[model samples]
Target: MSVIFTRRSVRSYLPKPVEDDKIERILRAGFQAPSAHNKQPWEFLLVSDREDLKAIAGMSPWAGMVEKAPLAIACCADTERSKFDDSEGAWWVQDLSAATENILLQIEEEGLGGVWLGWYPDMERVKIFSARFALPSHIVPVSMIALGYPAHPHRPADRYDASRVHYGRWGVSWEESRSGA
Candidate 1:
């Protein structure tokens, strides 16, 4: 719970490199995320090359922080491994999302800061990154995370709202439910 409350999106980073062990731990945590049918279809591309990071940052409008960060992890979805039917491979998105959340949480635990740069469902952004990384056809770029020591401090947002929670039934608000209890 402390980790969840302390996690925040960090865009500004100091000019410091992240230790390899910490990055590996974060990636390991990501793979621990649950997936549908236990089909873990996530592949991570760890980028430490300065030029590559800069180019990737330029690829996304919201990912300028990547250029300054010492490392970036491109979260990719492997279509071949993911289950698919008539509808598109929707399960992969959920699986990747869970993995991404785990990575972010692990970053906080490592005393490092990171920001998730969304790209999936945006065909143009996906295509750009895929081309830049020379990704194979089976792998689809879902999101990128810029990670490093934070240049500025950030506080976690209090997003909880009791009013938004319903108990027992759909229309029974928390207040009413508590009164009954």
Candidate 2:
């Protein structure tokens, strides 16, 4: 729970590189995420090369932090591994999203700072990433995580808003639900 509360999007990072064991643990956490129909259509691309990291930063406007981070993991979806073929095939998006969240949580537990950079749904960024890494047509890049030691300390934000939480139905506030009204 501490990890969940303290996990913040860290854009600035120290120059130190992340350890291999920590990296392995983070990847393992991602693999442990739940998926629809047990499809588990996630693939990871590790980018550590300085030149490639810089190139990735240029690929997306919000990804400049990738250039300085010691490691970046591209959480991708292998469309061929999806469970459905029709409109439901898009379930891979949710699977990858869950995996990405797990990875970010693990990063926080590892005492590292990281940020999830959106990639998928942006056709230009996706195309650039695919061409740069030579990814197959079935492989779709979902998110890029830039991670390393923290350059600055960040405080946890308490965003628990009861007003946004509806109890049995829409507009039924938690207080009303508790009072059985």
Best by TM-score: 2
Clashing pairs in 1: none
Q: Tell me the tens digit of each residue's lDDT in model 2 across 80-117.
A: 89866455558988999999999999999999999999
* lDDT by candidate, in order shown: 0.90, 0.94
Model 1 off-target regions past 4 Å?
A: 84-88
Q: Which candidate number maximizes lDDT? A: 2
User: Number of clashes in model 2?
Assistant: 0
Tens digit of per-residue lDDT, candidate 1, span 77-100? 998899655556478889999999
Model 2 score (lDDT): 0.94
Q: How close is candidate 1 to the true structure, as a TM-score?
A: 0.94
User: How many angstroms is residue 24 displaced in model 2 relative to the true structure, after the best TM-score fit?
Assistant: 0.3
**Poorly placed runs, candidate 2 (over 4 Å):** 85-87, 179-181
